[model samples]
Target chain A: MIPASFDYVRATSLSHAIGLLQDDPDGNKLVAGGHTLIPTLKLRLASPALLIDISGIDELRGIEVADCIRIGALTTHAELLASKPLREVLPIFHQAADMIADPQVRNRGTIGGSLANADPAADWPAVVIALKGELELAGPTRRRRIAARDFFVDIMTTALEPGEVLVAIHMPRPNRGAKFRYRKIRHPASGYAVVGVAATLCLRDDIVSEVMIAITGATSRAFAADSASTHLIGKPLSTENIAMAASLTGEQAECLSDHYASADYRKHLVKTEVSRALASLNGA
Target chain B: MTDHTEELHVVTVDVNGVRRTASVEARKLLVHLLRDDLGLTGTHVGCDTSQCGACTVDIDGQAVKSCTVLAVMTSGSSITTIEGLARGGGALHPVQAAFHEHHALQCGFCTPGMIMSVRQMLGQNPNPTESEIRHGLAGNICRCTGYNNIVRAVQSLASEAPRHD
Candidate 1:
């Protein structure tokens, strides 16, 4: 399907993209990787007057590890899966990236684009929210940070303002004794998560010191299961405790229902997926 | 609904090691550019929607669905279609030879994409297990062969003498 014709300009720099978006009276869209925007354009879901191509912008293209792991917005899923630093530091990213679509899609999809697109079933939101990551946003004048938990406003919506661009994602270095896992029941056709759960656990002397559980695909937006995560704190990683925590996965969530899966089925999947992820962590 | 002829973009891309330049609408997909404009019809468009990997091609050393990528997005990228897999037009690439030997394709509609995907996979991992090959080929689907022989074709290449370019 051909998208509606639109003027395209390749941005020369980060500021250039922001300037182009700010100056366009008819509204402009930024495309990196074009995995999400191009599809939306083809379906006529979006028709911006101008497309600011930021895929070639050097400022949005690398993975750097300082105090926190900073991933450029344009980092592709394939690149994330292949990073030796990410594998050593945050293997949960690998678990999620490997489950995202296939190699061809991964080669062209960008983390920033995925997060900004904010698909309800996207894997990055669950993982990022579970890890308590932060996103850096740039605009025509200023820059600021938004926590992953606050980033997603609703399905296909984000906290980004007009003329703002997501520059990078910052994830804190994993705490010592940190163990994390992401589990999903993927749609057979699109490879999107039917019900995805990301769990991050910290154990001190066999007792849970810190725990965070985030669920996706079950709700309109991916969010941390606060009540369920709180239930794991100061408890041993026992089957009974895990079961109790998993049961609370969708207690506060407004689960989504569609032709693919019913709300009841998604809720059931939340429990099952959380239990499975916790079990994998327990076995590890 | 207004006329958008002004949105035409002049894209210069190196396809199969040869430079090809054309003026296309900014919304034209890479697959259409390769097949319609360049006349390199070896890259088939099974599904225009990026779901089927039939339009798989190597763009700057990565295998991507051409249907999902705009031709303007690859202004200076070096793309390799299935036609570029052979050397000197004489000997087939090991992947092609293996597919031919193992009868990997049945109807041959998905051959070009399958071959392109396998070449990229082998370029990354010269030796891959059966499970790895299956995972690598997940993007490319073939309804006829049931993937039994396709997996064998990739495995055969992995077991052969590593080809150095």
Candidate 2:
């Protein structure tokens, strides 16, 4: 499938890339790691007049821990899988990266690109939402920080404005007693989540101090499993509380009905995955 | 649509250790530029959508799906295709040799992508477990072989001399 004709510009730097977008009246699209955008372009779903290639900008590719563990927007999934710091500090992220599409896709796909694409079935959204990460955006005028909960507006949409690029993601290290888990029902072909859950619990003496549960794949955007989270917090690690929390899996998120899975099936997954994730926490 | 406002630009990148330049349509994909313009058909295009990993290539020491990358994006970078894997005098890379020796391939349509993927897998971790091999090759789908010998081929190649250099 040949893509439709469009202009191409390899941006030399971050400012140049943003400037390219700001100046273009006909609308230009940013291409970083192109796994998401290129496929859409090839399908003729999007035909922009200008494509600002930002993947060449080296400043946007890394993961380092400073005040917060910062993940550069252009950090490839393969890079994350290979990062020793990520493996040591946050092994769960590495696990999710391992489960992403395949080696080739991981080699080219970027975390920033994935977040910006905002695929509801994507794994990062659930993790990011559950972790309460911050997305730093470099827009034409200024840089701003958006919470993961606010960043995703809908399926395939984000809070990014025109001429804005997601620079990096910020994840502060989890506090002591933090227990985390990520579970997903993977689509056989794309390896995307049919329904995914990321659970983080801070347990103090067998009672939950803080709990965060994020649901993806069953909704237009990942969201807090508030009902489930509320049910588990301040409660003992028991079957009753776990069940109460697991039942809140997709209460808020609208389930999608498609040829792949019915809405009922996805709702069932929401319940089952939440329960399984909770069970793992209890076993641990 | 007659009055155009923008000018298409030309960019050059090193491919297979050879300096190749092409005056391409601004929207041309790197895979198309490699196969159509430069006539490097060894880099097959099974899925232009980037799902199949058939157009895998190494850009600046990293395996990337060529179909999703723009030719203009690779300017000033070195690219290695399946053609570049075998060096002077046609000495097969250990991975390529292992693939043949293990009969890892069947239809051979996905051979180039599969071979490239194995190189990436072994390059990152010299000794990957069988499960790691399966997970690594998941991006490069092969309807043939059921992936048994391909995993063996990668397992064998991982123990051999590094495919690079």
Candidate 3:
């Protein structure tokens, strides 16, 4: 379906994009990579009078690492998959990028766009929540950093205010001697996760020291599986503990019913995928 | 006129080594610009949604769903379509030749998207394993040929010719 008619404004710079949005009282929307928003617009799920295309903005399009790996909002999945730095230093980014929608979707979809859309089925949100990432948002007034945990409020909702644009995503340096793994049950058509789990653990002689687990696609928003993580922490990697943690995730997660799958099925998937994710971590 | 100049919306883009300039609505999809405005009909539109990659085109050296990209988004970018796959003198692209030689297409409904995707796959990884080829073409779905011949065509190109898409 064609999107409703709307005026398009080209933002030559970051400030120009902000200006366009600030001028619109009803609020102008930023279009970067338009992989998600465009579809939403087409379905009339969202209707913004003015669309400020920020894909042309040069500032938001690269991956840099100093104290942390900072990814520009416009960085495409295809670019992430081909990034030598990300592959060498943080392989999980590439692994997550590989599982996103199809190749065509990845080529045009942006990290910032997905984060801003906050689709529960999106894979990146799960990764960000697990890594304790920070989002750098630029608004007409000021810039603020929102924790990935707090950034996502619910499905199709975020902590973003009007006239604010997600500028970049900041991921802390991976802890040394840390083992990480993520697994997902992807929706066959859209490649969206039916259930996804991202787990990072600092293992000391096969016992969990620092464990962080984030669950996505099983609820309205990406959430930390605190109960599950607590179960794994200070415990040896064994089948018994893994089963206990997986069970805790089922109890802690707020599953939703949808046409694609039922709430019960999602719970079951959360249980199975968490177990599998833990197993992969142990094997690695 | 609201004191705002009616800025010239002229865009000159390089498509298939030929330059194209047209004044278009800001809301026009790139597929419309290429097919209706520039008369490049080889890029077919199967579904308006981005799900079907039938409207696939190479934009700025990357394969993207043309149906979702605005024409203005690609104002200065280079594009490659099915018509541009062959050489100026009628030499078919290696991937296209392989598809024809292997009978990879039946109804040809999804030929353009399949061909464009194959071009990108071979360009990215000239020699992809069988499983890699399957994953690579996972985005491009085909009802006919059952994907067996398509896989063979890509595999054949990967092994023997050493040609880039």
Highest lDDT model number: 1
Candidate 2 lDDT (Cα, whole model)?
0.83
RMSD of 1: 2.5
Report fnat in order of the candidates: 0.75, 0.71, 0.46
Decide which is better by DockQ, 1 or 3. Answer: 1
What lDDT score belongs to each candidate, Candidate 1 first?
0.90, 0.83, 0.86
Pull out the clashing pairs in model 3. Answer: none
Query: Candidate 2 on B63-132: residue-level lDDT in tens?
Result: 7788888787777889999999886649898888999999998889889988888887777788888777
CAPRI classification of candidate 1: medium
Candidate 3 - chain A - TM? 0.96
lDDT, model 1, position B91: 89
Instruction: Give one digit per residue, the lDDT tens place, for model 2 in A1-284.
Output: 66677777779999999999888634688888888887887888888877888877887878996557899999988888889977776666887887888777787889998998999999999888888899999988899999998999998989998888899999988876677888999998778999998988887888888988898899888888888887887889788777767666656657998899999899989988998887887747
lDDT (Cα) of model 3: 0.86
In order of listing, the candidates' clash counts read 0, 0, 0
